[model samples]
Target chain A: MNPISSYLSSSIGRKWIVALTGLGLFGFVVGHMIGNLQVFIGPEPLNRYGHFLQGLGELLWVVRLGLLAMLVAHVVFTIKLRLENRAARGTPYAVTTRRAATLPARMMALSGLMVLCFIVFHLLHFTAQKIDPSFLALHDDKGRHDVYRMMILGFQSKAASGFYVVAVGLLAMHLNHGIGSLFQTLGLNSAKVRPLWEKGGVAFSWLIFLGYASIPVAVLTGVLK
Target chain B: MNLHLKVWRQKDAKSAGKLADIEARNIPEDASFLEMLDIVNDDLTGKGEEPIAFDHDCREGICGTCSLSINGVPHGPSETTTCQLYMRKFKDGETIHVEPFRAKTFPVVRDLIVDRSAFDRIQQAGGFITARTGSAQDANCLPVPKVAADAAMEAAACIGCGACVAACPNASAMLFVGAKVSHLALLPQGQAERTSRALKMVRTMDEEGFGNCSNYLECEAVCPADIPASVIARLNREYTVAAVKDGVA
Candidate 1:
């Protein structure tokens, strides 16, 4: 038991927590992107899809609560690890040189912070409908919440759409370094596949950026409406 | 060649230190970095001033005792140990900034020398294996696979140098620990204690206050032995399996 506690507190242990939570969040992001892309399918299908999710009553809340728990754990463990990391370097070097580390690798904490803020604003904007209470009352011809219309209206404003694009861009950057790092942390990497995983991570992250940004771009271009 | 040297000058571990500008004149182009320091110390002794305190042994690349960070690199411009770095690598009159490795765990004992006993402690924790106390086993008695032997040899190449820690942005010792863990775990002799070794070593490593590996790979860049970052991945695997087993049993 003592060894287990110490093991969990170790650097590798914190990495497991951070890496697993990051993977779970990545799953949610991909799933959310696919679901939202349904907006391009037309209003009725999108609204019905939204209604079906709301219909799952307890299961939807369960998923929401699970996401929340994972988010908190991710944030808390990351902060703890970050503080330890900062403290480990007692003093700064007189001359700093970076030879092997990439910009994305060095900027994980910074990018993670930006993405977390975006998540907060995102929930306020869409899930709670706090940004525009009027969207809450919009019902389709079938009396279902017109989510497709809500999305179009949401992105019609240049500022909101622009902000969404930038936030997701930051998320993509985070994943640019994170997904490859996740493989290493989970002991899934070896010499032969390391380069492949790293390149794949970069490519996948950009794909997500395009997938997410396409909607806002479509809305602003008058294609999704 | 002449050069402007901004070297750290700490009296001792408890005192704050700053860079002292010392001019190195007529230094030989072929002189190793440590020899240059020797010439400077000799001149300082002639002037009745305190000589700079730095660590070195064997005056060759194999020993890991030299611990100066030259121009913000662990071992100067070369991909080798500081002792092997020569004066020719720098231009005439280059202002070389020399500082000690600045990890909190490897605190500055004096100018250009930090206490690396932290590494020794880590080594003692589990960087070893249990075997029968007897004469040397026959060479072919234990037939290790060529790949395993090569990997083990690679891990064993680490000289317990703290450069990995110094170069890491997080001051992590994962590269060093990874090397040690991988070195032993790859062999048949290390099988008996593999489980406890991973757990105990990691526990000790954490208690020593080294930071997490963020996969920056700076450690690999600065490692004199050229230990790859894959060792860290191997360490993660070893520790995960051990911890899972430990939790249930």
Candidate 2:
């Protein structure tokens, strides 16, 4: 606990954790995005892919457990760093009314929390096969539960699709800062490279949001059934 | 060029401060910002009024002595120190609002003179390399990559100016503490005492009543040395590592 405490308190230690956990989560997002793109491949292929993933059974659980650990570690480290920063500042500095904090810096924490909440709800709605009975009843011609069909059915409700859209939008905002910050924390940012990194982060975030959100929107609009 | 100045005037720490407007009629537009102040002081002297007393030395922007919140910016609109700011940057007949560095730890002594001794105390707590001086060892004795050495030198360039504190909305000395920690922690010469040094310096920085860094980045922007905010990140990493090592022991 003391070692963990010191790690929590140290500057570089926090960054190392952030970088490692961030990279892990980034990899997960890439894989998740690719798997999700199956939705656009049409229902048959996507449902088959989902069943195949479900067939992995114990191996899939191992992968999921590993991802859960990584996510938990990332969240814990982030909250610890934030709290430490607050404690270090004994009093607030004064500023004139004309000079306000920039929008991105001010909203980073809020956006991050929103993304966290969204992830939980997302897992409940789509992954855990709970909360929605219609998703549980979804089956393919082969008599296997079709996760892809359930995803489409879930998004058919305007309220659910709207919520997913908003969540994905906020996730983009979180990634906008988080991605650039990950490079900076790892000591990879420089004057020459920062602008490129910033642009890359923006591009990556938009791509993820657009790709992830499109499925739900398409299903809700009847572009997919 | 003539300019109107509104400067904060306070008799003592306990007294409520006020903005005292004074006319600074000058003939030279090319004068440096402080030089313009000198002219104003001379005018006040001629009128049998007390001259505005502000902290300044070296005028070369090397020393971190000159501190003032010009208009709303820490060193005026320039990305440099107040001493490096020239009157040529300002327009004639413009009204400049000058005030002392406003932070709880930095109380005004008189006029623009703030007691920045808190920074000094934090530095004294651990900001030095404890390595004993010896015969000049071959620079090759320690193989430091070029990148690490460059980062260390950049951190070492901090002049202990309280500008970072003044510019920060939280008055956090994360930049200063980060700079001090990184300067030593990154170098082979400073590695032996890295853990202890970080612990002592950070404790002192916190004890001095400086605010935490919320990543506002104003400290980096206002810093005359242009020290990067990455140093703070490095400091955070070092501190965490040290704490972990200490815990294991």
Q: Model 2 in CAPRI terms: which quality?
A: acceptable
Worst 10 residues of 1 chain A by lDDT: A1-10
CA deviation > 4 Å runs, candidate 1: A1-4
- Per-residue lDDT over B17-48 for candidate 2, one digit per residue giving the tens place of the 0 to 100 score: 78899999964877777888899999999999
Candidate models: Cα lDDT each:
0.91, 0.78
Task: Grade the docking of candidate 1.
Answer: medium
lDDT of 2 at B89: 89
Return the clash pairs for model 1, or none: none
- lDDT of the structure predicted as candidate 1: 0.91
Per-model chain B TM-scores are: 0.98, 0.96
